[model samples]
Target chain A: MIRLERKFASLKENSKKALVAYLVAGDPDISTTLELMHQFVLSGVDIIELGVPFTDPIAEGPIIQAAHDRALQANTSLDMIFSLVEEFRSKDSETPVILMGYINTFLANSKALESIHERGTDAVLIVDVPGESSLEDIGIQNKNIASISLISPTTDNDRIQKICMSSSGFIYYVTLRGVTGASNLNEDEIQKNILNIRNSTNLPVLAGFGIKTASDARALSQISDGVVIGSVLVEMIQELSEKKDYKKIYNYLNEISAAINP
Target chain B: MDNLRDLPNSDGFFGNYGGKFVPETLMFALKELEDTYDQLKSDPDFLKQIDQDLCHFVGRPSPLYFADRLTKHYDGPNIWLKREDLNHTGAHKINNTVGQILLAKAMGKKRIIAETGAGQHGVATATVAARLGLECHIYMGAADVQRQSLNVYRIKLLGAEVHAVDSGTATLKDALNEAMRDWVTNIDDTYYIIGSVTGPHPYPMIVRDFNSIVGRELRDQSIEHFNAFPEAIIACVGGGSNAMGIFYPFVSDPEVQLIGVEAAGSGIETGKHAAPLNDGHPGILHGAKSYLMQDENGQVIDTHSVSAGLDYPGVGPEHSNLKDSGRAIYLAVNDKEALDAFHMVTRLEGIMPALETAHAFAALDHLSGKFNKKDNIVINVSGRGDKDINTVATMDGISLD
Candidate 1:
């Protein structure tokens, strides 16, 4: 079986919904961001989405934009993000790490996407190129990490099928019509949407975008394979940056993870 | 992290503002600027050269003046003006254009190209190209050419070619599309002197820092005039380069109100305005997401402002942050009011402002009569009326009647 399929089966056998959390690499401070990642996995985060901030992140809102700013200031590069993954591996090797960001950042670093994926990232979600078939069609094919794509309300059945065929790990189904971090919800609509995607592929359909609370995640997991939470985790980091100890950020996520499982 | 304007650790931010959040396309350009500018600032060699050039070439210190009659006309409070208009190229734009042109020359770039809306920046580019003996090309919307014919003539006389852009709305936005296209096409051999603090990364940061001259001069002048800083500083926001330039120095001074006037060509309620902070939704535009006017379907919508310079749908991301944080309050002024301010300032102060500056003039009523009184307001008279003489004359139903 494929590695992504294995990951899904393992989580299914354990009766645990995979918890995926994202943070822009090198935000606030580089060392602290890495340190916080180890803390997050320790607090039961199953997968990490380490975002590489691009100069132009059209899909993101202001909160993520500021995170991009802090990361760039610390001179975070594609190579640095890989080294960060390796550094995190030294402490913990079980949890999966995904490099999430724009394609331009990798294109600029002289490192091809496939080569960088070989450094140990388990998956990638190129926000702008969602469900687009460029990864396989392009000269550089990443064999190690599954290329994840997002399906939104705007995505049609034909495109959804294509995304599912191209997807390896899971199809990220964006819940809202707009960009990430929006607070609007329509469970009936979302349940129907995820069902449409699930009908097309046996691959797990993970829901993302504005999943802030355990109730939201738990509600989503009922219909979907799992839930991917990002902005809420990022906002939690920003709020606690004032408190000075970033290690405590994982504590916030710990509560959310327990409530979802409970 | 702490708001520090001073440098042992100014690093990249300006009092909790200014930092790089850009892609790698601009990293070379931004790093080049940071290193070279730090050297040029204190290099006694470059300073003496630019200072002498400013006096004999671009005009020095611009001027600090009191627009007393214009102040009295408002019927509320005293208004002091920083006469950036009197500068040789006719506005604060020359300050940035000159600095960039010099940097381009030092960096060995032989060709200079720019994008403009009202032709204010085009004239500045043409002026610098003439002084530096470099090849110059400027792209302006075809509509701006019809409106500001004399500026078109002036640029031609300076021997620069003006490419009439016909894309998008066939105005400022189109001109920017053409300019960016030109830069990307010729990145190896050309220097793209972006006109405002709007564009991708380094630009918003670079342009604001260069225009910081206006803020520095005003801070000293305000202390000289009112024995302290003014209660408020108002500037029209197109891309917000001028406002950021002046506002950067005062961002941390909690007592002073930093007012940014955006072009509400029609009232904000009319759905025809370019007030990014007031109405724009968050989405990717140009290269970054600050605020952008988008359709209900989430597609970016084209905007209209009688003033060509203020005719954009989105604003710089930095300005977006300021609006969100409450560090600055933005207000909008419509076309009729701006036209009225154009004629009013021309008649009262004998100064004709660029249509973009007229947006600042339109906010006087919003400032004096309606808002708090006993507040000293310093308006950056960003440009001269010379370019807008025909615009004002046509609106008055007389070409000197």
Candidate 2:
């Protein structure tokens, strides 16, 4: 089984919430990116989403795109990403690392998702793949590397059911109708979407997008099983990578994880 | 995952180029298009609709005519012309436009908007929309309106609202700017049917796929009629859809020489040209990175040519890819050479080709130095020359008579 499922099942046993940290792979270099992934888990990151770099990433915020651009400029390939995941397993195998990226890069890189079943990667979140066309249909729904899903404010009720039914991992509930980092929380809408998603499936619903502040994470924690922060973590990388140290990113995510718990 | 030619990721693009790139909000929609277009490409109903539309409406299998007089002028082997102008709306634009209108209707979109240079794109869009019963709007420059009044009337009569753009230069580029704004704002209900095989990602792939029929037909027809493939396949390159449509299939055939002729305006050495592949550097235009005519600061430089259709600052990414691979060769033809061919085609074969076609004809003359007269070359005569009558009349310093 994927580490995410093991972690979620353990969360039910321990009666605790999970903390997910998202980072763009190859932001600085393969070595530094690998170092950052280890630090994320050390800082109590329950789950990790390593963003695959793409030439054109429209869905990502400026900070995330900049990170992807840097990674792409360094000529980082999918082989390097899978190797990073495998390395993550050498030290600690408890935390899950989901490979998240645009469909083009995913199709360009991954020969067969099943081939990487034991590569230590947990799940795929192809941002451009539809709910109706799930990972199971494409022969990639192996228990070791299932597919996570993103539910937007624009997704209709029928499609939400389709997504919840097709999705294998915890559902990521997008908080707004705009791009990443474009909007803050709409409490009522988030609660309503969560309630609707809750009625559809037993999957743990994590709220992401625009959870930039500590207080935002705390508030979202009150309503969901986990809070996912991507752009904020990437923003830290952008700020600290200028000074040649990504340890600041580890500290920043730790702060958000602390806020959600308290 | 099926055939490389299969739908959804046809030409290897999802939503045709409008794939997921940004925030989570837009990701699902683009994915829907990606998944839908792929499956739809092979669906029996989808294939039937597209085939029926092309056969009865847009018209299919444009003729392969032997340009005996023009071929004899070059004093070469037999040169044949694929008559895309014989299609319902005239030009190869209808082939893709019709397919997209069907796709738009299938996608449940209600309105259609198109951008035009010299009104050919507008005419093509309006023709498809009228046949499909979809609401249509066309953005054309005020300058193009004055030049192509008949075309404007043709589109308007087909039940489309023509928005005369008064923007900078008031030409095709400005018209496209307005059309993009409309698409961005009303994307929920509108489908922007791009004219050429340029733009970001999927547009290059989609427009090229739609236009590739020209090449597919030519490939078979050349074999059926001549019993062998021609030595060269040539076409004019604007955003390079027609050229790419006819050139892409033959690119893999090493024996078949593929050439794209660019509008060299006065002369390439003079610095005023729309010869992007011939002169431009790699840069961004309409989103995707490709060969572009830009200045030192990377600002897009305005281009000039006798044909309004060819005056663009960039070529498609696939062309850039093709150029890098050396699978194809590009050449530039000046105004004078194109004009001379313009008169030659008119006098010899009674075919008044668009100024764009004149450039392809000029390429045949230019390559006479490279290949022997025995080497057969085929030119894609994209459109009729009626739109250029006034421009051609004022130039050459002579009357129509």
Could you give candidate 1's per-residue lDDT for residues A1-262 as a string of tens digits? 1435666888899887777888988887678778888888888787788888654454555577668767776777777788888787777666778777764454344345556655666787766443645465423466777878787765667767887888777778878644457677679989999999988888878888878888898888787877788887777787777676765567767876886677
How is the predicted docking of candidate 1 categorized under the CAPRI scheme? incorrect
- Model 1 ranges with Cα > 4 A deviation: A1-262, B1-27, B38-42, B296-298, B370-374, B393-401
The TM-score between candidate 2 and the true structure equals 0.61
Q: Which ten residues in a row have the lowest lDDT in candidate 2 chain B?
A: B14-23
CA shift of A192, model 2, Å: 8.0
Error of 1 at A85 (Å): 33
Which runs of model 2 end up more than 4 angstroms from their true locations? A1-262, B1-30, B397-401
TM-score of chain A of each: 0.93, 0.94
What TM-score number comes out for model 1? 0.60
Tell me the alpha-carbon RMSD of every candidate: 18.8, 10.1
